[model samples]
Structures are given as C-alpha cells and as structure tokens.
Target: VQPSTFITHVAVLTQPSDGTAGRPLPRQPVVAAMDAGGNVMTTYTQPVSVKLNRGDLDSVGMVGTRTVTFRAGVGTFLDLRIDRAGCCLHLVFEVAFGLFRGFSEGFC
Candidate 1:
C-alpha cells in the first residue's frame, strides 16, 4: 500500500478592539482538523496571544501569522511571525509524496 499524503488548511479570526491604552491583550484561539476520504484523522487547536502597548505604535501595527505542519503518524511543527501590513508569511509542508505551500496575510 502507498503512504498517505498530508494536507493543510488555514483560517483567520479577527477581533475588533477599541485601541485603548494599557488595556488587556486579546486572545484568539484557532482550531483545525483534517479528514482523509471519509475518515477523521487529525485535529488540533492553537492559542494565539496578542499584546498591544500604549506607547508602541509600530509594534501595535504588527500582526501575528503562524504556520503549522503535520506529518502522518507523527507530530506537527509550527512557525510563527509578527509582520506588518502588505507583508506575507509563507509556509511549506512536506509529505511523503510532495510538498504543499501556503501563505497568510498580515493585514488586519
């Protein structure tokens, strides 16, 4: 029998804030799952923490982007970055057969 191939999917969730100073940071948790043919194979959840400082405008403008890769019968690897608008984050996932690539936006 041939080895199973890996696939990846990404989703973005945004929460609007008042942009107030000295306020508590926001928490955005994301969950992802994959199914092969008709069988549920894998599931995972990622918790994202974002903090905005009062005096740091440049840092506040930066958005968080993360990439996750899962291997068959193995664990997953994650790559994270904080980027400003107009920039993009790239992710590459390697499988038994080939490679899959994906990108996420920095725009809020």
Candidate 2:
C-alpha cells in the first residue's frame, strides 16, 4: 500500500449522545483521518483537537482532553462532558496540519 495517500479531511466515526449535565457523554465521540475517497488514512497519525461549537455566547464549557493522538487513523474522546445542561450542542474536530474539520451530531 502506498503511504502516499494523503489525509484530505477528518470524519466523526461516532456521534456523541445526550447525557446528564456535568456528566460524561453516554456515547463518547470518535474521529478519524480520512482520504479523499473517505477511507481511514491509517498512515496519517497526528493529534486531533476537539472543541465545543457554541453558536451563542453561553456559559457552556466542555470538559475533557481537548486533543487526542490518532491511532490506526482513529481518535476516541472518552471523557467528554458538558459542564451544564444544554440542547443542540455540537463538537468540532480539527487537525492543525491541514484545513480539515469534522462536525459531530447535535446532542444535549
């Protein structure tokens, strides 16, 4: 296999699910580096960062390690949480080496 395949973007493998306020997400988020054909680019091992996408200036804060290193092209955010109750919140995953970004499904 040609290690020449480049990472074109990031993808959310698992979407976060609703959970109690101040508690970890019932389903943690998972992200992956992807090739142009949407295949996991396992050769692309780099740190991916996640952040809360707060559309408005609310006091909502995300609690967890903001960055995770890719393993076999995937990164799982195990301890992600919301500091307060909210609806329609989303998480954005990014990699600094490129213009890649992935958005998670809306969750409470």
Candidate 3:
C-alpha cells in the first residue's frame, strides 16, 4: 500500500476516558517530514502555538498527536514528539512500497 502523506507541524489533541489527571507540560519538539524515497522533504521547527487544557477528570486526559505531509516518491520515515505532564513521548515510522505502480510497457 502507498504510504500516506507525511503530516508535520500539527498537533492532534485527544482526551482519555479514564478520569485521570496528568502533570505539567514541556517544550514541544520539532516535526520532520520524509519523502516516499525516505528523503528529508521538510522540517517544522516552529513552536506549536496551540495549547489544550483539560480539567481534572475521573477518567479523561488530553493527548496530542502530530503529523507531517510530503510528496510521494519511494520510501518514507517520520519523527514526532509529545510532552505532557512532565512526560515525553517520541514516535517514528517507516513507509515501504505503495499501492499504485508506474506505467509499464505492457500496460501502456
């Protein structure tokens, strides 16, 4: 399957349903985008200016997810960071082949 476009410099805030409270926040990390061929397409070092505050709950807390989009090519990789309640999280994923194939001799 073709890799989805890279998503960067965006924060996705989510809330849990366990009525739990988290700690203070930290400095946000930069976002990185990768092309389909696994090349660095772009980087987002701008600090995200958005903030989400969820009051103490019995089973809910806010969670953030960032995305970076890039043009299609061959392979892909991405780096993301999330800091909340004095905790930090990082994620990276590699994209393999895609669904669509280029024009070949027989098909054309």
Judging by TM-score against the true structure, name the best candidate.
2
Model-by-model lDDT, in order?
A: 0.30, 0.87, 0.27
lDDT of 1: 0.30
The residue-by-residue lDDT of candidate 1 on 1-108, one tens digit each, is 332243343222222322223332143322223324422234333222223332334443433343333322222332222344322222222233323222222223
Q: Per-prediction TM-score, please?
A: 0.25, 0.91, 0.23
- For candidate 3, give the lDDT of residue 23: 28
Query: How well is each residue in 50-82 modelled by candidate 2, as lDDT tens digits?
Result: 988858337889998889999999998999899
Output the lDDT of residue 70, model 1. 34
Residues 1-108 of candidate 3: C-alpha lDDT, one tens digit per residue: 443355322222222111113422232233233435544434422222222222222233334443223232212112212222322222222222222211101100
Number of the top-ranking candidate, with lDDT as the measure: 2
- Runs off by more than 4 Å, candidate 3: 1-24, 43-58, 63-108
The C-alpha RMSD in Å for every predicted model, in order, reads 9.7, 1.9, 15.3
